[model samples]
Target chain A: MKNKTILLASRPNGVPTQENFAFEVQDVPALQEGHVLLKSLYVSVDPYMRGRMSDAASYVAPYTVGEPITGGIVAEVIDSRNPQFPKGTVVMDRLPWQQYIVHDGSGLSKISPDIAPLSYHLGILGMPGLTAYFGLLHIGDPKPGETVVVSGAAGAVGTVVGQIAKLKGCRVVGVAGSDDKIAYLKEALGFDEAINYKTVGDLKEAMAQACPDGVDVYFDNVGGEISDAVYLKLNKFARIAICGQIAYYNATSAPTGMRVEPILLKKSALMKGFIVSDFAQNFNTAAKDLVTWLKEGKLQYQETISEGFENIPQAFLGLFSGENTGKQLVKVADREG
Target chain B: MKNKTILLASRPNGVPTQENFAFEVQDVPALQEGHVLLKSLYVSVDPYMRGRMSDAASYVAPYTVGEPITGGIVAEVIDSRNPQFPKGTVVMDRLPWQQYIVHDGSGLSKISPDIAPLSYHLGILGMPGLTAYFGLLHIGDPKPGETVVVSGAAGAVGTVVGQIAKLKGCRVVGVAGSDDKIAYLKEALGFDEAINYKTVGDLKEAMAQACPDGVDVYFDNVGGEISDAVYLKLNKFARIAICGQIAYYNATSAPTGMRVEPILLKKSALMKGFIVSDFAQNFNTAAKDLVTWLKEGKLQYQETISEGFENIPQAFLGLFSGENTGKQLVKVADREG
Candidate 1:
């Protein structure tokens, strides 16, 4: 069988381009014992993947040049030598951006299509969901009646974060790039307030107006000027969970902004950074809560799905430009029995 | 009897000078039934006091212009109408910078002259000590074989912080402004390594050389370029205790520097700012450990005593220039029976 794979052509200088990724066709190898032959159904393209494209030391290893770029993918098991993952079983795992993958069934997590859609495992029911769950609940620790300000509030993790904060009885305020996202966060997600950062006259003033009680919990996904403004209005003992810095992900040079120590000192605040995997030990507990919330219709999610395997690079690049509303994904192939 | 008191004449524009303080003389009022006549002996001059000199919102209420500047002062009860405190009893409390004070004795903490020196109540056994204890043990939580770096390492809090981290079996590196302070930290305080931040050609390079294992815990007493350099050397899961930011205390305008969120995110680190009072519920536990360490000779302290009540303003100004080695105290008056 013929398989197509996307490889990291070169490390990006600033914002990544089409030249940074290359596509190659190869013959799919036969599945070996204890291995599974997987056909990609849905591939996730997230802001965090930008960190992997660089050679910098990070939580996850950087993507090697001329190698298949790997990420969270929902795939159908077409052929399996392992009984644990039999044929026709849909699973999710960190897999390469390939049409077909030959993999040992080590890290593959079985996904139940009955609970939600197959692609939902790549988004709200998967990494983005887990990231928001742990980062917001565990780190942000929003208390009832307190105000929560989440940047990039229309994106995957940010959407879930704002929703969870609202569920926790917090006054949820969101900061996003577009009016559409701002409206979606406020109208659909039930956020107390939403500010279009791009359109706001003065972000700091807008944030103050949004959070009248001052920001008690800040779920930071976009770190830069938005975060700087948030720091100014932090209430005493505020909790800040630094989940992602999408604003600085594409910067070629070191990004500089307002020093936060003095502000944090004045507010006696806490700022912590983490990836979702840091809370892996408690994933089952979080997953249970997340599943229950989704089932009860208390949680909502959106995805910007780009069609075809060839559009994966463009889909990923579009993340930096705020092209997608929620979880950005690439639909590579259809599931087959 | 006559009483002399220092008042905040005007708010400091940047670095405070003698012009900001005014001395006033008045008649000492007769003590009330619940009051004690406190004679100020040793008055503490802390960098944190600079915050109150401004009208800005802070953990402590800003000192009102034309009102007495109050701080940690070890006083002798010359006359007392309260049964709780008798004549000649030494007490420590946040009191006005006055030669004589008619206080209600509500917040007075009785001090023992035998435990250490009377001045020690303003340094090793007082606020700075407690600040170091809670901010280090509770926030930093340095483990054995870990690398702990403390900025302002020769200051009262930093000296104690470095010693405590050493007691916890961690490799301790100190950052100070002067060669004398650096030598004092290494030779007198038993710091593993010391960096003179002012003299160092490249602080980042020096920190890299000093903390080869990377910084696991950072007890930051001075925030500025020194802190920026320390942030670069933070190891994964590093914890930073933001105790003080003396570097920007005298700045006329808002200070800005390198953003720390991305660095913290990349390393999965934690940075928290706090005043010692934030952990007041656990102060007794910290005091017990601190007292035990001091008696065991495991902890040592130094204080620069500026004589005369008239020089208190100059003594406070000296702190910004890093003139004091450990604790900075002004000897107001001799204790009287």
Candidate 2:
């Protein structure tokens, strides 16, 4: 059988386009003694992946050209030479953007269909969930009666952050790009107040109205002007968790905004930047808590899935445009027994 | 007897001048039942005092126009009606810029002459000493073998910070203004490395060479371009203690510079701004530890005393110009028995 894979054709200067990716077809190699042959079911497209596309040194290494774009993928095992793997088993791994993959079980976790869904393992039960969990609890540390303001509030991570802040008995305010997202956050996710940042005339004023007591904990997913405005409203001893900077991710050159240290000094605030993987040691506890919250209906999750393996690039590109409201993913194939 | 006082003649637009203060001579008043007549000896002038001169709301209330500028003052009680304050008692209080004044002992701490010099109460054994103690130990938390970089290294708090970091067994680097200050930091204070930020062409490159292992803890006393340079060299999970921002204290408008969140996010670093008073609850232990360190010769202290009451404004103005190498204090009069 033949396998079709998408490779990074070229690194884009600014925003990525269809031309940045190329597809290749090759015969699927037979599994080695410790290898398992798998067919892709779902692939996660995350904002952090934007950092990998660039050559600049970051927390993670840059993705090389002519290599398959790899990320969190859920696949069903069809053939195996290892005793640990059997046919019909589902697994999650850092797999390439391809119709089929061969895995050695390294960095692979078996997915149980009884948990939630296969797609969830790519999002709420996975990276996005852990991002919200640790970033809020560990960094933000929202106290009861304290106010929390989260940017990118309608996105997968932001939505979970707002819900978790509410569960901690904090007054939660959300900022998003669209009116639909604002409504979804307030009505569906039970956000105390949500604002459409694009429509707001003055974000600082809008934030002031939402967080009357001033923000004590800010879980920031979208940085730039939104964060600058948030800095102005920070209360004494406020904690800010920097999860993502999606606003400047696609910019061709470095963006300059407000100098942060002066304001941080004035307000005696704390700001920290981090990635989800930094808390890998605590993932097991976080996943269990997430599962319990999911069962208790205290945590809600959403996804924007595009069908077909060919649409992987499109789904990833859509993140910059704010086209997807939730966890953006691509469905490669149907689940099989 | 006549008492000489300096009142705020006018609020400064940016950098304070002699015109901002006016001298007044008034008759010393008799002590009331609960009050003691204070004869000023030594008064402290700090960078944080500049914030009080402005009308903007901050950690401390704005100093009122035409009122005597009040701060940490060490004085001797000449006449006392309050039984608790006997004559010849050396005390510390938030007193005014005056030669002789009356105080109620509400915020007063009786200073024992047996402990240290009378001027020491306004510096190393006083507020500035407590500031370096809590800010570095609590916020920076420099672990042994980690690299600790302190800005404004020749200044009062900065001097102690570098010494304490060394006491903690960390590699200490200092950024000062003058060559003399740099010499003092390396030769006298035993700083591992000292950089004259004013003379350096590219501070980032200088910092790179000085801290080859990268900066793990940054005790930031002077903010602005100097701080921007420090941010570039932060290692992953670095902790920054924002004790002061003297560089931007005199700015007429907000200064904009490089955005910090992206770098912070990439490095997973933590930056916190704080005033020494935030750790008021732990002051007793800190002060005791500081005294112990001083007695054990592990901690060193320095003072820059300006003679006469008239030089108070000059001493304060000197802070912006980097004129004083250590804790800046104005001596009004000698202790009266």
Candidate 3:
């Protein structure tokens, strides 16, 4: 058997191109003691990956050039050398983008395939799901009847954030790049109001019209002009959860925007930036709540799955252009591969 | 008896000038059943007053044109009709800038002069002191051995914030404009390091050198380039307490600076803007702690008191020019009146 791995070819200047990634084909090594030979099923492509590609100091270490890029991946244990991991067991772990990998199973969690679709683990039941869960609930703390305005509201985490805010009885307003996403968020996802930022000539005015009561909680995913507009409408004691800055990820130069401290001071507001791992201790509780919501059909999720392992780079790049409406994942192989 | 009252003559275009204030002389009215005739002892002039000079929406109501500008004041009750407030009682209240006024002792808190100087109620034991206490202890939450950087370090709130952070066993670095203020912070207040921002060629490098450990708690009072420099040195899970933005309080145009969301997100940090009143429920506890510290000689405060009531406007204008150190106030009259 052979394994195919994708390596970080070079650091990106701004937006990553295909040249930044390199593919390698090699023979799959035999599993060592207490190890399992896994076959990749689904690989997640997220906006946060862009941050890791840079050498700047961040929560996660930068991806080293000429090293395999690692992220959340769902895999099947095709061959196991330890009793802990039997063959045919499906698991999810942060793994490198590869056709097959041999792992010691140190961090792999056995995921039952019966609860939801197998791909759902990489989307609604995985990192993106938890990102939305904690960032919105723990940080944003949306109160019922309060207005929640989420930027990049059609993306993976944003979709879940809007849903969760709605579940908390908040008036949800979504800001996305496309009209299709706006319609989907309003009609399918039940968003109280949706603004297509690309078409909205005056985003501040659009946001004002949507959130008449003023924004109380802001779940920021795409930070830039959209967030600047949202900052203007923050009510007294507003809470802002800074989840992602996808809009400025590709900027070659340092990004500058309106000064926020004055606005925050005037409104006596709070803005916090956090990652899902920060709330790792409460993952079980969040997962249980998410699963309960999923089982009860009170929560819905969408995935933009691209086929073929070779198309992973394209799927990741698509995120910058707002090509995906929900969780963007690439299907590398079938479960029985 | 006659009263000299200062009114907001006109809204300032940029930095307020003495021309914006109007003085009117009138007879002091007799106290009503629930009112007290108070003689102003000391009137505080803080940077936050600039926010009220304009009609912009803020945490507090804007100072109405042609109306008295109200702020923290130490007064003596000369004649009291209310049993709650007797003659010779010294009290602290948010009162209008005036020499004498008849007020309904609604918000007055009797402050004993036996504990400290009567003006201490307007400085270390009052609004600025409570501001530093809550903004640092509650929001900043500086842990032992953590690095705390306070901007506008020699001012009323910044001075107290630094002392408190030191009491919490953290390394405190102060950023101020004048070398005199810097010397006072290091020598008098015992700050670990102090930076004279006006003379410092490279503020960011100076901060990096002063705070060898990256800043963990930022008590931001001056919110322009000084804060922009501090934002770059934030460590993981850093907490920024936005107390005041005196630097940009008089900006002719809307201020814009480097975007902070990406930096906050990368560092998994928190930045909150608040006034002292946000933590009103815990004021008594904070006051008790402050008083204890003062009694124990663990805390010391400096006052920049301009003599005579006529110098009130000059004292306030001097704040922008960095003329005063510690709490800036004007002496209106003696305690006995």
Q: Pick the candidate with the highest DockQ.
A: 3
DockQ winner between 1 and 2, please give it: 1
The residue-by-residue lDDT of candidate 3 on B1-337, one tens digit each, is: 8889899999999999999998989998867798899999999999999989999887888999999989989999999898998999999889999999798888889998788888998989999999999999999999999999999899999999999999999999999998899899999999999999999999989989998889999999988889888999999999999998887899977789889899999888999999888989999999999999999999989999999988899999999999989999999999784
Tell how far residue B34 is off in model 3, in angstroms: 4.5
Residues B1-337, model 1: lDDT tens digits: 9989999999999889999999999999877798999899999999999999998888889999999999999999999899899999999999899999998888789988878889987888889999999888888999999999999899989999999999999999999989999989999989999999888999999999999999999999888888888898899999999998988888887788788999999888999999988999998888788888999999989999999999999999999988999999999888886
Clashes of each: 0, 0, 0
Which stretches of candidate 3 lie above 4 Å from their native place?
B30-34
Candidate 2 vs 3: which has more DockQ = 3
lDDT of 2: 0.90
Poorest lDDT segment (10 consecutive residues) of candidate 2 chain B? B251-260
* Cα error, candidate 1, residue A156 (Å): 0.7
lDDT of 1 by residue, A134-192 (tens): 99998899899999999989999999999999899999999999989988998989999
lDDT of 3 at B220: 95
List runs of model 1 lying over 4 Å from the truth. none
Candidate 2 residue lDDT tens string, B210-310: 99999899999987777777888899999999999887888888777778888889999999999888888998998898888888988777889999988
Report the candidate with higher DockQ, 1 versus 3. 3
